[model samples]
Target: MRLLSMITLALAFSPFAISQDPTTQSKIADATQDVVPSETSTQPLDFWMQKKLDYSTAILRGLAFSDFDLIETNANQMRMLNKIEGFVRNRNPEYRGHVHAFERVTDEVIRQAKQENIDGVTLAYHQLTVSCVRCHQSLREAE
Candidate 1:
């Protein structure tokens, strides 16, 4: 009930208005369709897990696949990390430990990425995975 109430309040405060504008409405609808969970996704917990997975995949592509240089790569990942941090903070206050762990990792990753330290980026990626696992475990337990 508390979760449902929070969701309602968040929706109420969201900047994106339900638009009569067809183009804007279509864009929102498309984004919603793009994010629809697979049938194997079980609950809200699984939904968030999938989101984290998707972020990780995007980060990997930005790191490995993109032609962007190291600074650009790290900068993009840093922005992504910040976005994930904000999302988790708003949606999962109970997972503070996991959030803090990822924050530290992201900070170090950004610092090291700036310094051109390949190993630091690698270690941060590993830590990111661990942080996700820790939170997912906690979320599953809560369910």
Candidate 2:
């Protein structure tokens, strides 16, 4: 607890930790602004799971930024991301490969988005999103 508090305090006081690079910040901000809202639902798992895929794709496309920001960010997005990651990490390879692909494509998409290659980013994001939906659809069918 003491070590954790000291580390947190140190991070808070560090200039390098406090301020993000302007260009990277701007790209992330712009990407975050682009996520479309998910449809409302009473089913918690389905709602969050579907939205997680959407958010993941948006981040990949550079249309949606990380949930670390204040503006246009989903309140529960980080939780959803963690949940998806946990699910993916524990699942069998056949079920988890899509998550790995998502991580790769989203990383590429974000890079493209920062480079201002909008079309390329969009294509990658679209492919990743489609994969997520397909995977979930398969799960649903299996059940």
Candidate 3:
């Protein structure tokens, strides 16, 4: 009897039981479509590359608007990405040097962003972009 009552209560509160409205179902489907996939579902290299692009874009946006909070968030993300396996593992000395250079510049960017030093951040950002281009060029040549 208790189990039956519990089932009855659940059914009573369930959306499908309350209404089979097409609009409600459509709304739920649309909301689910906006959900981001789990990190595990994405290819590691692709995921990190996309993150770098996204964080870089966010940093630019933050700089334009003097949004230190946004800059800090993205810069921190970039720092974390530097330590990931995709970035750090199995790298040759030259590749590793490039990675280290990128990290050093990124650290400077983070520090400048935290200090709200726009000019320092701008310089560091340019250096960071150069590091990215060099690293990517080397990677392409290696392939």
Candidate 4:
């Protein structure tokens, strides 16, 4: 219930507004501290996990196909999601720590992808996967 409430509040005041006009874009930076990509800013978290999963899968495909564009794009998207998620959550120290850790890994992945370093990107992806698992465990423990 609390998670649902938080989602509602985030969307209500967030860049998730239907149109990404100057006002909506401004509000996004106010809380999430980043420019949420206008294309995806409107989707609520209720259905956003699917997009996250899709992006993750695309990252893997990019690795397999040696597509730097795909990998960098998706990695950047994940970073944005991480920022929005941090604000939409309870904002305790522990939660913020998890967000920061994920953001670090996401940045690493983006950097490696841009450099076309498959080995580096693979290592960073492993770290990102582990971060996801740890954060999920923490969330369960909190509940």
List the global CA lDDT of all models.
0.54, 0.48, 0.69, 0.73
RMSD of 2: 8.8
Over 10-118, each residue of candidate 2 has an lDDT whose tens digit, in order, gives 4335563347567645543453333222233654445446666565543543354432232123322322243334443455555566666655655555555556565
Cα error, residue 20 of model 1, in Å, equals 36
Q: Please, what are the lDDT tens digits per residue for candidate 1 over residues 7-49?
A: 4355334454243256644543444433333333356545644
Per-prediction TM-score:
0.49, 0.48, 0.67, 0.68
RMSD each, Å: 8.2, 8.8, 14.8, 8.2
- Candidate 4: RMSD to truth: 8.2
Tens digit of per-residue lDDT, candidate 3, span 24-95: 445433432221112454444465578788889989998899898677667756765554433335478778
The pairs that clash in candidate 4 are none
Q: What TM-score would you give candidate 3 relative to the actual structure?
A: 0.67
lDDT for model 3 = 0.69
Give the per-residue Cα lDDT of candidate 2 at 92.
59
**Model 1 lDDT-worst window of ten:** 66-75
Predicted structure with the largest lDDT when compared to the true one: 4
Q: After superposition, how far is residue 116 of candidate 1 from its true place, in Å?
A: 1.8
Candidate 2 — what's its lDDT? 0.48
Instruction: Give the TM-score ranking, best first.
Output: 4, 3, 1, 2
